[model samples]
Target: MALRTLFADPMLRMLVAAVLLAALLPARGEARDTAQLVANAAVFLLFLLNGLRIARRDVLAGLANWRFLLPLILFVFGAMALLGLGLNALSEPLLPPAIALGFLYLGALPSTVQSATSYASLGGGNLALSVVSAALLNIVGVFVTVPVFLLLGGSGQGAVGSAVIAKILLLLVLPFVIGQALQTAAHSFTARYRHNIVWVDRMAIAIAVYVAFSGAVEQGIWTRVAPQAWAALLGLVAVMLLLAHGGAWLTGGMLGLPRADRVSFLFAGAQKSAAVGAPLATILFAPEAAGFIVVPLLLYHLIQLVVAAPLASRLAQHPAGDGDCTAPTTTATDRSAPPR
Candidate 1:
């Protein structure tokens, strides 16, 4: 049994951490605030590494597949906007309608580096595509999500904070482009030192945790968000998860994509990139509303990780879990195994 768990696939861990983090979010205090700070920093580092590893040509290639990935991202964003509208109408006592709705905004942002690639690896897909997809979203989200945020959220000038644009450009976008450049120039170094580069991933996660949790406590996250509200958020996460995963799988499959592509779609389509997106909120919105934007991202992150991991393991066993429609496949393609 010990060996089984030790050998157990890593993909499931994402879902576990997602639910756990939401459950563990700091409730309006210093501790939470401190944690939030750490988390922010951690995510930043991860973004840099993600940027550094990107291959320029791959990103260009992803542009070619825009018809496939872009529409899915838009659909997620649109659904979030519409969901926000509903939550706004309901206007529950617990629901800070704007914030509750903003959670939907968080949902729409897009998938991230660590988990998306990690899950792709678990599900036995294309790691290169996973990296490109995540990097593209981080770059494009600067323009796409921020505007949608303002539109759906209505001039949240002070809602998140000041550095939204800069942070996205610098921490997220700039690093990715730079990384791609580095990938080309330092091809030998990156290949030689790939193992060492993962330290960057861990550092980013640590910083994100400190910053997010700390801020939650410093601000009135507990009073504002509340337990019941969290419950509602969890329910919303499950629904979104189903939709994103199902939508991607069905759509990709219908397009006659091979199993490798389908696996990539399911993981990428379903998961949100909290690591990248959460810190972006800190830069964009108010300290108070930071928790709100991040809440959805966090929930989505955990759910996808835990859920994606198991599904990945299962799919690994069955390969074509899709049944009679099962297609014989070649060797595993893009498997994203990020740092433990």
Candidate 2:
């Protein structure tokens, strides 16, 4: 049926498997401590492996297109800041100042591989561009995103400190650099072990989810967050997702971007990267707040998968003779297909 198989993506499947493992066979008492370590290692290795898969050339090329990417990055940043301000003003206080701040965090998050490619493939956006864009977003987020979080993640934690920055450098940037260096040194090994390593990414995320959730659970974090807060958080998540998707679609038409590029923008721009955000949040925020900060990210992850899959399918099934998003942005390249 050419339908998207949830199991086709070994990482997604592994994540599902890990979640089921946690839910169905949750660690208890003495087993809980060891389980936590495994989960944390899993999360670390995920990014380590994600870095290993990217082609250095594509990341470099995406950098070359700064004219396109820079503006988009700025636009996202500005929109997030503005939304935070506006949402902060609501007298209902449905949105605490922290939420507005959290929105900015989610807004500043890096892009993902699967969803971006899937949607770029849908609307005929640039595959190479999508690849590069996603990579650059992740790379930049490692440095700037966390520092910004420290500076602006609000008083829930004071200004993000230099030591905090150092941790990010250690955990994320340093390991990613080491991974890239290793990949360059052992291209053939990486290629050979790619399938085995794919599971690493999923296991990593599940480990992250468990560790983050567990830490919060241990501290009785949910009891602190009101039921109304959960409702508000869900509402805010919905509005932001709608805005991201709708805004991307509208901008594609208004900017007159080629259909393929629009697809790239829609998928790449709209979705938040949990793989990147989870590790960063755990390291930066208070253990109790990690759950709150990460709730949006996790929601964003699920939403992207649920929303984008069908959305891509519908876009792909465009009616005959309809004006296609097949137009090229630079050369005659077909952005919809995998780059030849």
The global Cα lDDT (0 to 1) of model 2 is 0.62
Kindly report which residue stretches of model 1 are placed more than 4 angstroms away from their true locations once superposed: 1-45, 76-93, 97-99, 124-128, 154-163, 223-226, 318-340
For model 2, how does the per-residue alpha-carbon lDDT over 131-176 read when each residue is reduced to its tens digit? 7887787787777665554455354542357776676666677777
Backbone Cα, N, C clashes tallied per candidate? 62, 7
Q: Candidate 1, TM-score vs. the true structure?
A: 0.73
Candidate 2 regions exceeding 4 Å error are 1-44, 81-92, 95-101, 153-155, 225-228, 319-340
lDDT of 1: 0.60
Q: Give the candidate number with the greatest TM-score.
A: 2
